[model samples]
Target chain A: MAKNLLDVRNLSIHYKIQGGWVYAVDDVSFTLEKGETMGLVGESGCGKTTTGYGITQLLASNAYLKEGSKVIFDGKDFVQMSTVPSKEYKGYRKIVEYHPEMREYRWKRISMIFQGAMNAFNPVFKVGDQIIEAIKAHEDVTDEEARKRVEELYKLVGIPVDRIDNYPHEYSGGMKQRAMIAMALALNPDLIIADEPTTALDVVTQDRILGEMAKLQKREKVAMILITHDVSVVAEMAHKIAVMYAGHLVETGTTRQVFKETAHPYMEALLAAFPNIKKEKKERLKAIPGSPPDLANPPKGCRFAPRCPYAKDICLEEEPPVVEVAPGHYSKCHFAEELYGELGGGESNE
Target chain B: MSEENNDVVIRVRNLKKYFELHAGMFKFWGEPIYVKAVDGIDFDIHKGEILGLVGESGCGKTTTGRLLTRLEDPTEGNILFEGEDIAKLKGKELKSYRRNVQMIFQDPYESLNPRFTVQKTVMEPLIIHGIGESYDERVEMVIKALEDAELRPAEEYLDRFPHELSGGQRQRVAIARALVLRPKFIVADEPVSMLDVSIRAGVMNLMLDLRDKYNIPFLFITHDIAVSRYMSDKMAVMYLGKIVEMADSDEIVFNPMHPYTKALISAVPVPDPDHKHGRVQIKGEIPSPINLPPGCRFWPRCPYAKKGICDVKEPPLVEVEPGHYVACHFAEQLAAGELETGEEAKEVIEESEKIES
Candidate 1:
């Protein structure tokens, strides 16, 4: 079996709002193996971003992790030990400050590629110099060594080495995003969290960037958590898939199993809602009837019960447990087995 | 509902929109640089048909829409709406033109006035156009427009502010505002891009219903090809302020002639992993509009560009097949399957085993 890189269990996050607490992430749990790419997909207000932030310890001041939430990274409980500043490693002291306990793990162990590539770079500095600074900040390396690493990174991301000296304004949108990916890979981290990295690029440009990123991840054997609202994007590269609703993980499975043998009604609805390029045109897209539930005051039972077509009396009165339909596929639905029988293969469960 | 009955509602001929770029340090002495946002593009929208103007950012798709709606003044060309050139129309001519041709913006939240209630927001257009005889008549018209937009119990939503409504609801209100005038044409610029995926379909379906019921022609502008293919009867591919290809949505999708169009169609991510593996590689980024290339704007990035010929001569939009127009130096080569060697081309050809011929 592959070694596990990250394990998150019962992870819940809430934001202190004006009236009441906004439950951003509720009882979310998943594990990622080395060299695996997991896609966390959801709509606008879903807690996919919050789950990523919770793992990285980068939640805002207004946000707080609920009690009993645990994040284990490489066997170390990050939630428990995220406050102790590192005193052992004396490298990169001048560049990166060891303030928060999680600071040491941030760029060195795990990194994030933010949503917008336009705002990722500093306006005044050259792209090459900025990357070198990032490298020097994370590791005990000379300016020359960092510069060499930056040059290699640029090449890895398919950027010309000469254009590294160009300012942010000088580079095109796609080139800037490639540079952002290069920066994220500076430390050769164990895991990477890309939050809608290609949302801003053109379709052609988005394909190129994603293909390149997928290649890099495979070559380096690095685990990735790609967060996006588009299911098609995740379907391209993700090995494992996790569907998030208002604040819960509605489904989890391997890419093949989830796409072929989907067990949740929410997943089915999402698949139907997606506009497929390969499929013939339909009269109208199958839209989920109602909007996502409000996180401030969630409904009585399942969060998706209001919009689910298969929603029943049991779905309305009690929360559904995460049931394993197949050996590896799990879905949070009251009738996961029935759904598997109905939509997955159309065979009787008996 | 046949080709014989279809009438050309709007004809855009050689539309151009040039924006002046600032010259740094030599502001007074140096010659001004013009960014040709929409450099002489031509197309037509038939009655009650959805013409999808598809392109990436800065491709002049939005500018073309704005020019047609009279929101932005076109530097050159004739916008023939109902046999009259409305490009240079002013005063009362412009006012009446605005009433006939309405616009639906991309951002619903920003498009609506937060201070105004739903009733006032929809009524503003009718009031400006002087449509109703009295206040009560105008109120009745507003209710009917809201109902037409699929916002049921229109009276209940009249007093609600824009903030109280959802993103999809707000877009419905925007649609209602546009429909209140009973416009002959509607320019919907990325109307559903801001809404969530689940909510997006509702708005899209609503637009289709309105198109069918009102028989209103829509110049739908979007970057998303899937949505465009779903909503449009005809689609035009734009690149660097030029129409690279234009045809029936099926023809443009199934048998793309232009290399740029093929690459664009291939670039869209399908929800199936089994569909394709390798990406269609376009060499470089979209060139800046200010310093467009000499021969063809897309020559630098096109994979099938013939070196000497493509760089020296601009390809005119020609009809190689009936009703399908393509602008490419090697359109013949592309159609012949001569350039279909790579994985990208293979993927595009076999986009699905299920697509009906």
Candidate 2:
């Protein structure tokens, strides 16, 4: 097999809170193939966004990658290479990760389209100027060549070519999203990290953008990491999915496996919480009770045990390993096999 | 649900709202060009039915809500509330109409003043209308309103500030404020859009419960089609400033007739992995409201816009099925949906596009 495009092994990220350190991404390990799409889904503050940041090394200065953590992207141990200090003026090793050199990998290797496209471009400059700047940053091309590329990208993402001179505010939300996509694809990157690209958009606009991305991904064969709360979006776009819970990788599997054969209760709870528009009349939705655990000091064993109905003594005492219950399917619950049987052909699901 | 019944609680016909933006200090007196936010959209919300107004951002969904609620008067249009033109209401009559037609804002965080206590927030509406005689009586009414919103053990929340409560709780306070006035109708503009995933469901359920208990009709404005499926009895899909399709929840979701409506439905992420709802990748963004293309507003984005008639004329919303309405010219040629793959996806989209033409 060819080398993986991205490999995250035993990667744990921590934030120094009032009470010690919060384990935001606890020993999460996953890999992406050359063209496959991996979806990371969870509720707010479940560490999916943090995992995306960890892959791009975009964590805050207070946050740190714990010892033995490794992020190997495109044959480079970026963590070690990124920690080179500039000088010892302050005596303490003021770690500098994601340096200016690392920026070469940021847009050229992996690009991101965050939730909102509001600040993605400067309001003062024309949208074409911004796209031109992005292209000129990585390419040794003249302004004319970059402008041609911008026009081509605008056409590629379905933005009218003539609208390039317009400022960012001139475009609608959907147009802005298309512009963001166009900017991200300016350099034919191997990986694209879209963090809630559709959350800010409505259904129809989101649909068009997702369809554009799907077509582009197939055309370019780029590996994508989609971070979102909407499970159904993942069902359509992703090949594999990893679910997070209070900084834990509780479940990981194919899209078919996770939604159909959900082994983790938190996964099941998430599915239950969402009211399907396709569902029939008079059916009441089951929203998950209580809030997520305090991230500053999470639970000892299973972080979700506090809200889980099936929690037992062992679950509260020891952390469950990510056990492969079936081929290409993984779950981090002690009662994984049992929950798999329980999730069989749910009522109102069909 | 009647096809010919015209029980108009709020009738907005040929409505228009235009913002005058300036370039610089010299341009302050310059001829301000209109944004044309809501340009001549006509709709009527029936008695006791939850009418959903849905569209994408900058498509005038919020503006339509504000116009109906009288929060902002239209530049031109007949806002007939209970057969009287509300746009022409005088001071006392306007206050009475305001009490009759209240509004619940999208962000509860902003809706409820952070400095005020929960009791004060719920009581402000009552105080405005001068319902109660004494402070004690008003406090009693405030606690009762909290109870009506299902903020149980009402005293616990009464003392709390907006920041002290969760997003769901703060929204409950907003609902209580709207409900305290005992309005017959309300304009809920993306009420649960800013809430958490788990908390959003609770707010929706609470709104539905309120609709049932109080018999309060709603003009629910949301970008989410699925939300219309949940809280609403009837839905009208908006594009630019026109209703492309309007019908019952089942008819709209399963048997959508407008091309825009079909695209909207297909884009919705169904939770089931086995369901094969294919997305229609429509070209171009929602056309600018200021300068909309002639004929159908959705024609520019319609996948079947290549058809001759779609580009020439706008189809009026006509009831094709027993209560299901569509606004597409080629409604008959479109086929019904089948399960999974094949022409099923195409049929689903074509049927809706038919209404748009």
Best candidate, DockQ: 2
> How high is each candidate's TM-score?
0.93, 0.88
Error of 2 at B205 (Å): 1.1
Clash counts for all predictions: 0, 10
Could you list the chain B TM-scores for each candidate?
Answer: 0.93, 0.87
- Tell me the whole-model lDDT of each prediction, alpha carbons only: 0.86, 0.80
Docking quality level of the chain pair in candidate 1: acceptable
Docking class of predicted structure 2: acceptable
lDDT of 2: 0.80
Task: Return model 1's CA RMSD, one decimal.
Answer: 5.4
Estimate, for each residue in A296-318, the C-alpha lDDT of model 2 and write its tens digit.
Answer: 88889888888888999999999
lDDT tens digits, residue span B1-357, model 2: 343455668777778888755657636775665677877666677777798888778878898888877778788889888778998676898898999988999988888898999998899988889999999999999888899988999999988999888888888899999888889889999998887677788888888888888778899999888777887888888777667778887788888877778778877987777777665646556766666677777766665564467778878777778667777776645535322223444664564354233
The worst-scoring run of ten residues by lDDT in candidate 2 chain A lies at A85-94
> What ranges in model 1 sit over 4 Å off?
A83-100, A281-283, A344-350, B1-6, B22-31, B339-357
Candidate 1 displacement at residue A17 in angstroms = 1.9
Evaluated at residue B21, the lDDT of candidate 1 is: 70
